[model samples]
Target: MRFDISGHYLLLQAFDRTGRKVFGGEWHGDEAFARDTEDPSGVSGERRNIQDLIKTLAASAEPHNAILASDADEEEHQAASDALHQINRELGQLKERLATLPHVTGSWLADHEAFKRRTDIESKLFEAFRSGDLDLQVGPNEIVQWRTWSRQPDFKVLFSMSCVIVPRSHAGQRRRGPAFIQLAAFEKWLCRFAGAATGTEELTPEAQLEIWLREKIKGPKEFSKPVYRAHALEEIPELSARAFDRVWDNVVPKNWKRRGRHGS
Candidate 1:
């Protein structure tokens, strides 16, 4: 739906889920206004009009020179995501070939080396987590770890990651988060070893690991699928508030809410 997000938020009371607003606000002389509809092509048309307007201005200035244009950080992330895909595709193909191979040979050894290097990239990238790794053992379940790390001197944090390594026979099913998240490992080494960015035909280890973590280590829903459902928001609102506050600074609660009855 089209919106004039300028001025104050002209909040929509109850918009039709199926309805879309394409033309909004006053149309200038020959210019068209937005139309509202939930049609599949409607939003695309609205966006295309915006894009055309942007293109007219972009000719004179760089792509992101306009106020409405995306920031460098957003573009950087998009580039990284694209890089992740191209590298992993080759890894998938190699895994398929390895599955089909029967016996060991010189060529097989070379292929094995390729596999080892791929895993090593994942390992080395995440080696920093070792220093503050903690084993949080739960009864008869997969192991969980709380990794402690500090970036600047003032800020310290504990990040959680779990793992379950599987043999080749179970490689299809056994996937988990990246090995080195404990150490801030994924960032710096990523660009160096990333195959997708290289334009090299071979699979990139960095890209492969990205895919690996995505498929293996999902949200808590994916992690605890068999045993549980999602937790209530009230259960950890404070933690959630802290995470949100880091981005917005406004969401952080001022003073704790005292608990118990008797007007406590």
Candidate 2:
């Protein structure tokens, strides 16, 4: 009888004195039975004998030693062992070469740390902006400096100002309103600014009216002064009603239609 272990089961084959297969089966869990015999019912005796052999093998001190394999199995096992040994030797050589290389340290490490710090600060800055703790306004000079430094010829500084600073002809066009700077664009600009700004510099309010005006312009073509005042109060709590009106009168287009008026 020879036993071959294949995955989770054990295959058993018994040969007669003439080297002809007398019984063959597979053992699973606690059961053993003849599977390929000519007359399975008649081979009940053979099955019992095989089961007894399996039990004896299981009870052996080293159950693995009880398994039987042909010469081909031994050769395959030797080949696999040699491959594993070769892999280990190659890994050892790689480790030796890596150890001989210089240790990595210096400017690159400092640059990485600086990048991480900038990321963390930028995240906090954006969070503050979203939560209304920080305003979008910055000085005109600062905006100009950033615009020049960015080297983006198409960068619109009007979107960042407190008023629609474009020519009256451009302002009349619907596309060039403060609404042109969507929240996403504004946040992107903020992120870029955060990256370039020194950690010690403080941001100032420069575009509160422009921000409010943009939102209102996006909604209705006609709105009342009281409605505008109410929105200003809600959106720009830091600015007084008088200050809001002053900025509104100065920046609002003269030809803008009111709720009751047909023309400017």
lDDT of 2 by residue, 81-196 (tens): 56555645655555555455444346444444444433333344335445554333222211122323224433332211222233333233332222121232243234433222
Q: What would the per-residue lDDT of candidate 1 be over residues 12-120, giving only the tens digit for each residue?
A: 1001100111112211211111222233344445545545654553453432244224555776656645554544454455455545544444644444443443333
Q: Highest TM-score: give the candidate number.
A: 2
Q: Which pairs clash in model 2? A: 137-206, 137-207
lDDT for each candidate structure: 0.29, 0.37
Question: What is the lDDT for 31 in model 2?
Answer: 15
Write down the TM-score for model 1.
0.19
Q: Which stretches of candidate 1 lie over 4 Å from their true place?
A: 1-107, 132-162, 165-185, 188-264
RMSD of each: 30.1, 30.7
TM-scores for all candidates: the values are: 0.19, 0.29
